[model samples]
Target: MDHLTFKLGRPVTRTTSQFIVYPAESPDAVRHAVRLGLASPEIADGLLSPGRIRLSLTATLVAQAAPGRPQVVALELPRPGVGLDLRQGSAAPAHVLSRFFGPPPWTERYRQAWAEIANLLRAGDVTDTSVVVLTAGEPDRAAAVAEGLILGSYAFDRYLGYRRKPSTERCVRLAGSVEAGEMRQLARRAITVAESVNFARDLVNTPAKDLGPQELEDAAAELARDLGLKCRSMTPAQLRKRGLEGIAAVGQGSPRSPRLIVLEYAPARPRYRIALVGKGVTFDSGGLSLKDGKGMEVMKKDMAGAAACLGALRAAAMMELPVQLTVFIPAAENMPDGTAQRPGDIIRCGSKTIEVTNTDAEGRLILADALVLAQEQGHDAIVDVATLTGEAGRTFGNVLSPVLGNDWTWVERLLSAGLTAHERFWPLPLLAEYREPMLGEIADLKNASQMGGYTAGSILAGAFLAEFSPKTPWVHLDIANTSWSAADLGYLRKGATGVGVRVLVQLLRDLAAESVGSEARRRPRPRAATHA
Candidate 1:
């Protein structure tokens, strides 16, 4: 795939093969066109009218210029309808253009808008674009544009016979007055973060045949070596010797052995130490309790949480964040065979024993040992993400993942980070009563709760893992729904949304800021952002 190269400066006038992009709402777009001698102000204004161009999420007004004039492209915003409401009896008059539409969160809207701009360019078969971002004087908004463009352009067509070739060397030139140095820095940061997200997407989109436990460990080790970080992997024999029977049993049926992949970034004199645990069920066939035919098709995506941690670790290393971080992935494949684990099987997961009430509920069993390993190292906090339940998907429905944790502070921090990254999460209560359903008759707990009959299944899975890290501040993100999209929406591609990676990167950046008492630490983050 070709990555985007960003440049800042005004381009010299050219008649042929020249296109300029502008925000429709910005009067400056028309003024700039007039200044560039592409069109008269009145002509440019007419080009942007609703009747002149069709607009859904976005619209483009393509103008054929005179021999020496450059072609003009205006990016139209959605008219007031559906999501946009007109507030009645407000101080601002309805006729006021800016106030005509109700206030959606401007920051996120800018991000989504720019992502649409990217889609518009792609539709036009334009790989290189000259864009004028109307940030309304906020320079930080420019970074959002860079982020949206990179994310919206992601595609996973590696397995296809004839795939659309991704742009190999695209360029986006920003023509603006923002300080050149600052623009470059912001753009670089956004590029690093978005590219990390795409890396995770690639991992999740890969077929299970090629990305089993050992391959996943190899990917982590390669990342660690490239970034100059520490990497270690534990084989099935080692895992069993170290008292991680849950991980060992889940993969015993498969030809491939399970692996515990550990990656670490330890900065000297670090202010905080954090552990991230991810459930890496490379292929979840539901074990002895096999899934239906249709359900099994997307089982390759079951390891999205592990891909997320790997992506975040890559970003932290590239960005050189100050906090010390460790990532743990308990990689396995849950396939049914003669040697597969069965219902009523009891497995020792570190300090606790779990009854395998349902072999399909295997993600939490592996994560249970990982959480124990995280706490064993005595990190400040632990966050584990997994595609652990169908209930979470049915509840959230690809909108936001559900998060349940032992500590409210850690939960709120994740929520705040999600808002900034635009990869959202919703908090679910970890009720004291939620723990009762997992209490096992023969073991310490049941891997799947039968008493509740699938009621609160997502929280029950979280409660099962929470038993291992009883003392550490822990947050569990159930990302089954958000990890892979059923259809393309906004910046997310059709598959492997790479949900938690951005949230983790943003969280680490926030923690790094708070570590040294930077000015960003004083700025309050919204508990959540309004999702479209």
Candidate 2:
């Protein structure tokens, strides 16, 4: 069963195997337990020892109890920095019949705590559950709890075969302080975002053999159909005809070929228009400039940028955000073959020509065509995300992603969105001098900087894309480092992390809100008139 089946309800008398979780900081814990009917004030006082709470077990079993009192399990909040340890044995109860949760304050750590809870839930495969989330009645805080659980419950075990088990049918009931209607709305929004993020993660985790350029196109087309969005695609020949040769040249070596997928969502009244361009290198073998075996192991994740855009589009459409969103994915497989475009090759990218200096530097080439396409469509702003450079990985070390852009306003806007979404991004300058190395002797520009070697590789790649959208407000994210995690950390597992989706969705949300406020200010007021 899917992990998203959740409901909201009022707290009731405890059934067998119920989990009563509350903040240790809550005043009169014993009194609260008596009211919930889990224990009498005298018994509850003995159940919790301030010293034992932190030093003892994560969960204490209240086995068979007296006739009147309920036999419910008790879990007191652990001290700060101590994680939730809910990984009970397989022989444990099948369902969480009920829960009494007094969620802690909504801090960054609090958000992470909820996510870790979700991870534990998924790991244990607890079934037919009902979670009572109290304390965080405010909309945003409540949503944070929901997001943490949903995102943490995400697992990519499709290929696990006999080892894989279906997700348990889980339910969460929100209670306390918050109104029922508001809680329901918050839950829906959080679920939408989590579903989209997991969708992107699935795409990234799939192997290249199963998800080539054509398969990626099929996925995008299917999502567009499901979401009622406008979808368009261009074949290799069509790309060449439109002078988008950079994309065609990159995929010429691979038999799977290349295609460009465009997904558009235009609401009845759009407040803002923006284009999202993502690099869709299904497998980056680096063409003739082949990478080592170690470098190519995770090459399948090269298409994570496209996955991010598709995922963001899904959330934006589901939420029905008042924005005109256009997504451009330049899909290709950069494999080395006799037909592949080698170094010293000249390719046309829109009106500009790019010299293939390093065939491994193929992401910028494809993005150049897609960015120009966005510009031709006259988008108000453009944001392109790609797993583009190893230099980015070396610089950030998975802690953050590097972003470079021609416009500070858009750059700052994206950074702000990252902060709100809990994604980290550090801005790098598009230094004018960096552009010189990109200038080519044979073509208008070279894909890689010959003189600079690997110096500022991420910045130089961003500079290459900046050429196509010079006049438009644009920001480029080199997510090479943050897209895939090396090990399971916090709520994120040891695979594709779906980094860019949150930032993109948050950016759209902020833009929509700003547009509404601006329009409100611009609206004309009805003025009282004297009798004429």
Candidate 3:
């Protein structure tokens, strides 16, 4: 792991490199400053700019000179009278500053600044740290910079070789008043949470060859053991005995076999029972309705939801929230084989029969069984997360997860929690009328819709899962857009985003509070009968 340290001192009288900024209209002054700044005879002549500045400084210089020892660019802003120093890589120095001042709406501006800085850090191209000096003397601005730098320096590099090492410690220094100890603690906590999220991403990024259905189940079981949670892993035979046809039929094609992973975290005084179901299609080859080459390239991340659920459970156990939690992972790989279920096959799923209209639509089938199992265990509220449909990506475009639920209040609560977690979600309606199209003439319901396909894919999938949770307040998160990122954003890299873990954690916390309050408000009644 890389480390960053900051120090402060008096400004050096001698200058090395200068970056002069004049009034926006004074282009000539900028040219003069640049020319003087590059005046050293040892420096390349082409770098002496007579007029205007180039944005691609490094690329232009590299193209001009024969490669040897790389030249370092040290930037300095010319200021007279009072002097201040910004130094890094040392311990405590005289008057170290760590404070932030921004717009009146502090948190939003703070987040935006962090987002911008995080994007730069993740780019991996720029080697120099950006130093901003504020003359306004606002304490919050300096605090925000320190906070952003602390959060922005997170990276996911678990797969790196032992021989490889990063050359520099990425550092951002703030020049304002703030307590060093408090800032250090804040930075440590931020990095801890970010690393946990990155761990989830690593699990999602692993190839199906290394992490198949059984392997995923084993991983979950190990996690439960490590956290001291009660865990039970059901084999295909056990699941079959429990009448989990949805999981059995979808997993029949894979040699690795399928499993139902149940993990329980019970606190000493439980407030609420919350169950989370995740679609764990470790590798989705689209089954008999095979996917195209481009579509199959990233299918290893199809288990992203399961990864999030497992990650949330780990965080919850670590945080020790006052909630009884249960996690259900229906692990399977949807592949094409001689024994694979066909598109027209009829399967009984948790007391409800489903006609397989498309073998590619396998995620919902697996989740149906998991939801039924959760409800049977007497959970008050159920939530399932999955990268279920391409329609979600088409609708939200990598920005938002679409949430659908039969209970409007629960959906709203989840939406609010997602906002606070920075995991964006849009509440989608579960119209009772949409159930008509899902009705099958030969079976209880059709897995794929005959009409309104792309427009309502998320809603239809939610409706399908809702069948199993007949009495439980159910929420379905179609996180197809958020699970994989086409580009990096903030602390997230351009791979598995680990979308739902934080949101699910927040939701669990909210549910726990609500359950506690509700129980406290109930009136006591006199006992009518006593049996001895």
Clash statistics: count for each candidate:
1, 0, 10
Q: What is the C-alpha lDDT of each candidate?
A: 0.71, 0.72, 0.65
Which regions of candidate 2 fall more than 4 Å away from where they truly are? 1-107, 129-132, 450-454, 516-532
lDDT of 3 by residue, 1-532 (tens): 1233321110011111111122212332222211112222122333324532322223323223212222122221121111223322222121222223233545434545554554444444333333332222233433444434433444445455783334343333222222434444444433334444655776788788999987887788788888899888888788778877888888899888888888999998877778989889999999999999899999998899899888888877876778788999999999999999999999987777899989999999999889888989887678899999998988889888898876666777789888756678997766666677889999999998944544478777777777787676778898888898776555445778778987887787676566555853232221111110
After the best TM-score superposition of candidate 2, give how far the Cα of residue 70 lies from its true spot, in angstroms: 11
Considering TM-score, where higher is better, how would the candidates rank from best to worst? 2, 1, 3
lDDT (Cα, tens digit) per residue for candidate 2, span 44-89: 2233444332122112221111112222222223233222223244
TM-scores for all predictions:
0.81, 0.81, 0.72
Clashing residue pairs in candidate 2 (N, C-alpha, C atoms within 3 angstroms): none
Q: Candidate 1, clashing residue pairs?
A: 2-168
Segments in model 3 whose C-alpha atoms lie over 4 Å from true places:
1-112, 115-192, 452-455, 512-515, 519-532
Highest lDDT against the true fold, candidate: 2
